[model samples]
Target: MDLPRSFTIRESGHRIHNPFTSEKLATLGRALGLAPGTSVLDLACGSGEMLCTWARDHRVTGTGVDISTEFLTAAHARATELGVTDRVAFRHGDATGHVADEPVGVAACLGATWIGDGAAGTVELLRRSLAPGGIMLIGEPYWRREPRDQATVEGCYATTKDDYRPLPELLELFGRLGCGVVEMVLADQDSWDRYVAAQWLNTRRWLDAHPDDEMADEMREDLATGPVRHVRYQREYLGWGVFALMNR
Candidate 1:
């Protein structure tokens, strides 16, 4: 019913959880031209940043579902902080099969497509909750450059070369699924650094404060190796973006 403690611990300080920076997220929101009272459904919405922020900026109302109670707590707090408590809601639940009770203007599964098994399945899941002509937002990673070897692929955290497609293939995927790629905001190397490097500091700070905790050793190892692996393999070979789609 909840995410692993280690997962939340590693991202304890993250608001948007993915490689997207605040500016990139805001840009996507603006690009959509969200209107007041536009309803959104966000699955696997880590910390509910997208929902809460859009609720404030665009006056969109939304529900965010996640399996992490810790993240849900933070999401609720963020809604209150942004003075948008009436506009957004966060529920602690599995996002895999969840759908909006009512069709929404936007249906999203950002950065956690695995909830529906993969991009295609995730799109299917989102479509179940999308109103006619509604936008679907999918956040995913792509190969920036083809990896040279299996070792490099593993270093980038992919078990195989097929784990992620290149950008063009990803756009083609949307077309195959009967969706048109309408807009996208990509992550730069600096955004990747901001996302991955910040995790190291969160892990390190947790280790300093809880050296005797059961997961301390694991956190220490991640802190020691994560940055090197990220900069050398992932940051250079991987790119991430949140794409906006409309049914074709």
Candidate 2:
């Protein structure tokens, strides 16, 4: 029903849980040409950053769902801080198999496609809640460069080379799934650093504060190895982006 405590601890300071920075998020919102009052449904919307910011900037109304109480608390605070509490709603629930009660102008599953098994099924899940001609936003990772060995695959957090396709193949996947890619905002190494490096600090801070805690040793190990793994593998081989799609 919730993310692991270790994960919450590692990302305690994050607003947006993914690799996207605030600027890239705003850019994606604008690229969608969201109209004032547009209705959006965001599945697995961590911390509700995209929803709250879009509510403030584009005047879009959205409902965000996540399984983390801690993140939901942060999301609610963000909404209040942004004066967007009236515009966005955060629900603590499983996003998998979640379909909007009403069709929405935008339906999204960002970086948690596992809710529907994978990209194709995730698109189908989102499509069920999308109004005709509405946009579907999917945040996913692709291979920026091919991994050369099983160790490299593990380093990128993939079980096998097929875990993620390259960018072109990913676009082709949308086509095969009856959607057309309309727009995309990608993450660069700098943004990736911002996301991954912050986790190290959070882990270190947590470990220092809870040296005798049961998970402290695990966090310490992660702190010891995470940066090198990220730099050598994920930073070089993985590409992440949020893509906007329309039914073809």
Candidate 3:
């Protein structure tokens, strides 16, 4: 019913929980042109930043589901902070196969497409909860440039180059799924650094506070080596974006 403790600990300080900066996230929300009372269902919604922020900015109502109790707690607190508790609800549960009780104007599974195995299946799962003319938002990674070798692919955190398509092919995938890519907000290198490098600091702080914790060594190792790996490979070869789609 939850992500591993280590995973949550590593990202405990993250607000958006992805490579997207707050500005990029707001841009995507504005691009959606949401109307008052528009319903959104965000699967794997991690701290529910999008739901809470959208509720405040766009006056949309939404529900978020995530398997991490820790994250769900933060999400609820964020809703309260934004004074949007009345507009959003968060549930601690598995996101895989999750569906909204009512058809929604937007359905999203960002950054955790493994909920449906991969991008194609995740799009199908989101479609099940979407109303006609609703938008589907998918946040996914793509290859910025073709990797030169298996080691390069692994450095980008993929077991194989096929794990992610190049950016052009990724866009082509939406068309194959009967959805048109209407809008997108991409993550720049600065955002990527913020996302990944911030985790190292969080890990270091955690390690300093709990040197005796069983996970300390692992966090220490991550803090020691994560930066170079990221700057060397991920920043160079990987790209991420949130794509907005509508059924054709």
Candidate 4:
């Protein structure tokens, strides 16, 4: 299976699918202080960036699962490029309910937590594959400010404001799940701009290449309005971070 063509096209250039930049991702890896040969299982690991990079930098061994075949291909290539092909493997499959064949030191479900429906359920799903006292890496979005109205919610690409909680509430959620927030690295507006603005260019280039495609019109419309919408709504209202958690 694969992600929608539109999504794959829009994010084709991205090494990390979420708002995270390579530097932020590297910082997270360092913060984790992963030991050599540490075992990691990354769910919904787009392009296997975290797994591949960590394999190279921390000497970790891991498997990554994602539904997107295109991304899996990129992941394999990334592994090769990083000289970690023997250390990391990527599988094309649904990440939801995916349990590792063996317990892992780090179990992560980043960005696509909807695989377990939401953050709490996602944490539970990750725990199923985690070794005792292992870390759970969860990447989620929180509302930086309350959306003003329905228009604001729509602008943030959410159906309702309930889609995300404020930062404090999100931390409380981890506590409620019987985990403590150990470490976190957040995305700033610059990284957000880098992520969202890059999509605009990708969409524009794709539209030029596939002028007759049926999706062109939709992409065109999105490219036309995406920047302003992101600046006004998502950049201001949405805060994204990858949190490191441990059982309390």
What Cα-based lDDT does every candidate model obtain? 0.94, 0.96, 0.94, 0.94
lDDT of 1 by residue, 1-248 (tens): 89888888889999989999999999999999998999999999999999999999999999999999999999999999999999999888899999899999999998999998999999999999999999999999999999999988999889999999999999999999999999999999999999988888888889989999999988888888888899889999999999999999
- TM-score, candidate 1, is 0.99
After superposition, the stretches of candidate 3 with alpha carbons farther than 4 Å from their true spots are none
Tell me the spans in candidate 2 whose CA falls farther than 4 Å from its real position: none
Clashing pairs in 2: none
Where does candidate 4 stray beyond 4 Å?
A: none
Q: For model 3, how does the per-residue alpha-carbon lDDT over 134-205 read when each residue is reduced to its tens digit?
A: 999999999999999998999999999999999999999999999999999999999999999888888888
lDDT of 2: 0.96
Per model, state how many residue pairs clash. 0, 0, 0, 0
TM for every model, in the order presented, reads 0.99, 0.99, 0.99, 0.99
